[model samples]
Structures are given as C-alpha cells and as structure tokens.
Target: MSGFVLNERLEAESRLVCILGLCQLRLMNDSRWPWLLLVPRRAEAEEIYHLTPLDQTLLTFEAGETARALKRVTGCRKINVGALGNVVAQLHVHVIARNPGDAGWPGPVWGLGKAQPYDTNSADALIRAVVKEL
Candidate 1:
C-alpha cells in the first residue's frame, strides 16, 4: 500500500494522535467516551484481510498496545475494541474505554445518542494522556 490518505469521514470526526507501527492513531471527537481509532496506513484497505500477513500482526500488536494505554489513561473498568465498517468502509479499529453507567453502557456506543464534543482543554488533556502512554 502507498500514497495512503485518511477517509473523509474519519478526518472530519477524529483528531490525529500519532503514527503507530502499522496504523495512524486518532482520537475520536466524542466526549462521552474515551475513544481512539487505529487506522492502518494501507491504501484501499477496507478490511483486515487486505493487509499483508506481517501487517496484520502489526495491527494487532498496535491495537493491543493502544487498548492498554487507553485503559490506563482513562482508568475505565472495561475496554471495548472493534472494527465495524458498516458506516465507514475504511478499515479502522476502535479502542474505547468504558465504565458502568456510562451514556452508552450495556449497549453499543454507535447511534445511542448525540456525541458531545470535547472542550478544548479536556480534549488536549486526553490526547496528551494517550500520547504519553503510547
């Protein structure tokens, strides 16, 4: 893969965090969840199978690392990781830290309600925390 570009929807919805071994880590805009997206820098990779075997391993490693970092940073009781491409065809993994009684608790976060945008200071703090852990 080459000349990789982020999906328009992702670009609009996320803030760039940093680059991982096989992915570009991005922070989701929603304040309701401590969400991060791991988007592989592989052009046209709308699914995991599209990546090379070695790249696949790297993605998994990166996702696991991101998930752990999220958990540590947020101190959430649970961590949710998924790659559902129904709305956005681009292949990206979601690493979210969840706690009981959260807005979307005991259910999927998608479409449960509106996403509350983070305040400037909160967003910066979260981004910095995740980056430091990573």
Candidate 2:
C-alpha cells in the first residue's frame, strides 16, 4: 500500500475505469484512442527518479499490465506507454492503444487535434470492459 492517492485534477478531468494493482487507473478524456493513465501512489512524486526502487518496479509492472490489457481489448497496431511530466508534473505513465491510421499515425498522440470526448454510455461500456479484465 502507498501513502498517496490520485490527484484531484486528474480525477476531475477524466473518468476512472478500473483499479490497476499498483497504481491509480484512469481513462483519458480523449476518445480518439483507448488510452489509460497509471499513476503510482507516491506522495508528491513529480518524476520517475523520485520513486524508491521497489516503487519503480511496481510502476513498470503496472504500465506493462495496462499496455497488455489495452492491446488485448483494442487490437491496436501499436501501444504507447510513457511518462513525461512537463504538463501534469506527476509521476504517471500513459498507456494508449494506437492504430496505424488513427488520428495521429506514425507519430505521437499528443496535440494532434481536438480531443473527441467519449459519449457517456460509451465511456461506461469501455470502463466496464476494462474492469472485467482487471
């Protein structure tokens, strides 16, 4: 167990779908991809280096698990998992399922276009699907 919890802004900005074993699991607001965010429960952790070795291993495991689950559900041609704290400044990893012809293909999923928000039912359905796997 960790001493930290999910950030307020992150929870407010996205829909939480499932609980990954070692992290806070959230579904991104953007509907363009089957995207998930995994944030380790480390107090005030703003970078990967802030984590203890054991926590780092836990984050890696969570990220890999998220990537595998997303791949299995979405059948994406590729999956992107990374942690860049420039914007949110939190020690979090992103797991995105990407298709070859997605909104941003052969490139990063950041800042490509306006985010297409998922419909309420769609979001619920996706969340349930992910939860079933979790």
Candidate 3:
C-alpha cells in the first residue's frame, strides 16, 4: 500500500479532492466539463481487474457517488462514466457531466478542443461543492 502513488500525468491534469473508501478522488482541471477521476490507491494497478474484489466493489460505489454528485452540482443533461485506460493506463474512472449543447455534446470529451483550465476561485468553489456532496 505504501508503494501506491498517483500517476504523474494524472497529477498534472487534475487537482486532489477528498478520498472515498477505496479511491482517491480528483477533480479534472478542464473547465469545458465537470469531470471527476476516481483512482484506486492500490500500487501498480493498471486495470480494473488488477484490484481485489472488495476494492472493485468499492470503486463502483465511489464512481456512482461521484456521478450523482456531479449531476447535482452541474445539473448536466447527462453523466458519462467510463474506464478507458488507453491513454493514461492508470486504472482511473472518469465521471463527466455533460450538457446537450456542450462542446462535443454527442461525443467524448477527449481531444475535442483545447482544455480551458479552471481559475483558482472557481476550482476551489467547485471542489467545496462536490466534496460537500461526497
């Protein structure tokens, strides 16, 4: 467990939020969407199946809670939850809040447009709101 460390790419792309039961919750820095990443703290876990059964169950619960919180905070038209580790390969689940007219509305947010990083004030506020829900 002590060997567990956040992937550097993930660390650069997101801000640390509070930890859930089995994952370290992170707020993606892009302002284009309200997104959260749930990363299990198990070391060398590059895939969902790498987790123990209990950890896998906890990850699912954490992902659901994150999706609900994002929906309540962003009031998005829909929520997108996925675990595509093709790029980062760090076993992270993405919970994205999507609106009908949002950029790449009908598609994935990846590579849609330049990421608009959140301002400190907005980031802090959002973190507070979501953490409160969690």
lDDT of 2 by residue, 1-134 (tens): 44686777677767776666567889988898888988776788988888888888888877887788788788888899888877677677888998988887889887678878899988888888777765
TM-score of 3: 0.96
Q: What is the alpha-carbon RMSD of candidate 3 to the true structure?
A: 0.9
Error of 3 at 20 (Å): 1.5
> lDDT per model, in order?
0.91, 0.80, 0.90
Using all chains and alpha carbons, the TM-scores for the candidates as numbered come to 0.96, 0.90, 0.96
Judged by whole-model lDDT over C-alpha atoms, candidate 2 comes out at 0.80
Q: Write the per-residue lDDT of candidate 3 for residues 1-134, one digit (tens) a residue.
A: 57888999999999998977788999999999998999898888998989989988988889988999999999889999889888888789999999988889889998677889999999999999999887
* lDDT (tens digit, per residue) of candidate 1 on 29-69: 99999999999999889889989999999999999999989
Query: Model 1, which residues run further than 4 Å from truth?
Result: none
Order of models, best lDDT first? 1, 3, 2
Task: List candidate 3 segments past 4 Å from native.
Answer: none
